[model samples]
Target: MPALGGKIDMVPGRMHGLRVQAQREGRYRGQCAEYCGEQHARMALEVVARPPDAFDAWLAAQAGPAAAPANAQLARGQAVFLAQRCQACHAVRGVTAGGPGATLGPDLTHVGSRRTIAAGTLPTHAATLAGWVADPQAHKAGARMPATRTLDGADLRALAAWLESLQ
Candidate 1:
């Protein structure tokens, strides 16, 4: 499909695969050309193709832990994250959630550094993070993340700030 702007295919066993040479130094969006499930249209991906130097820098950052909270607000946000048991479903390297027995949702070690969140459903930013934390279902239908209505406005702000700092 011309709208997709990339070649895509799905092999047996429901595996979608595509290989595209790095053509630019920025993010490229793609979608599954093959329908695999009810939300096939919503399944999207982003490829961050950077120059060698930039790619190396990004790789190094991703290999590191989530950046430490810079302020008391961010620190409080980290605490709220831990308190809410968000670690169980996500992994932030050098953080308690990545310690042991962390079930895989997505490795959020350097999520803030990424271009998008929720499987490329939204841009990566504090506002997006807060919205996702507050109610993931609203952004992505059938998203496994449960709503966090329990978090008050203050905690939500702090948590979003902390996550945004994890670059």
Candidate 2:
């Protein structure tokens, strides 16, 4: 498919679906394609175009349980994440976070598999993820996420690494 441009006009009460196929394994970046709401500009899309086998493998991984932290640092990070109530908004299926109400935010079951985070506000990297986790409001205005100033740098790094390892 040709490159898709942002700024898609909305058709009220309509559900549109566009199907496209990727020929390679890579991350495809796009935008909302329509002005849906106030945050439309920040609404971005990241489609991971993986080969069939790789896609299946990723699917299997997502279907399975969230991996346990390999080291003490990651374990600490996970603990911090849970303690901070991050699970209240986001979800990492297979991992027992909060219940259904905790699923208010994004489904992070395969977040590490994506190319971007915060609806494409930042790249899916350790540094960016750490910053996002630290101060999401700074990056996106009127964001529901609150700043995690209580989490020190070390804990932030460990949490970021743990999130990145989700892939």
Candidate 3:
């Protein structure tokens, strides 16, 4: 593992496979130095900060399918996703993301399959993702992705709802 604010090559099974023991408080972040792709700086990194019970609930939700809503909001959310250029850096398997000029960010192919979002700062929930989308910098200063503040109220709800459904 790299030292705080220091760069170090990640060697698997040695210092690379290291795991940070979960703390009862605070958060963390890091950058990959392998030149994996573009927007490496924009790649979100996080760790959970909730207590055990809350973490358990969030974990369960991530492990399961997205809950369905009875309105066309989710469809509208999909449209918003495309129109907003989210496909530029992320990929959603079975979806039309990951187009040309979009090899920089982490693959969101199985975002719903992920247990945490923004690396680990927030639980993989619609509300949390919506918040992150609205203002990434507020949660993680110096984030490469600018805040997508155009979303508000129902728009945020619908987009988050649709994203959560992608699981």
Enumerate clash totals for all models, in the order shown: 0, 2, 3
Between candidates 2 and 3, the one scoring higher on TM-score is 2
All candidates' lDDT scores?
0.80, 0.76, 0.66
Ranking by TM-score: 1, 2, 3
- Name the lDDT value of residue 59 in candidate 1: 81
> Mind giving the per-residue lDDT tens digits that candidate 3 earns over 1-167?
23333445655567554445544454555556576444445454545467888889867765553344446998878778778888787665545545685655566545755667765556888988798889987776666677898776888888887887766
CA error at residue 108 for candidate 3, angstroms: 1.8
Off by over 4 Å in 1: 1-18, 97-103
Model 2 CA deviation exceeding 4 Å by range = 1-16, 22-27
- The candidate that wins on TM-score is 1
Which residue pairs collide, candidate 3? Answer: 46-119, 46-120, 47-120
The residue pairs that clash in candidate 2, if any, are 8-33, 8-34
Query: What's the C-alpha lDDT at position 63 in model 3?
Result: 54
Q: List the residue pairs that clash in candidate 1.
A: none
Best by lDDT: 1
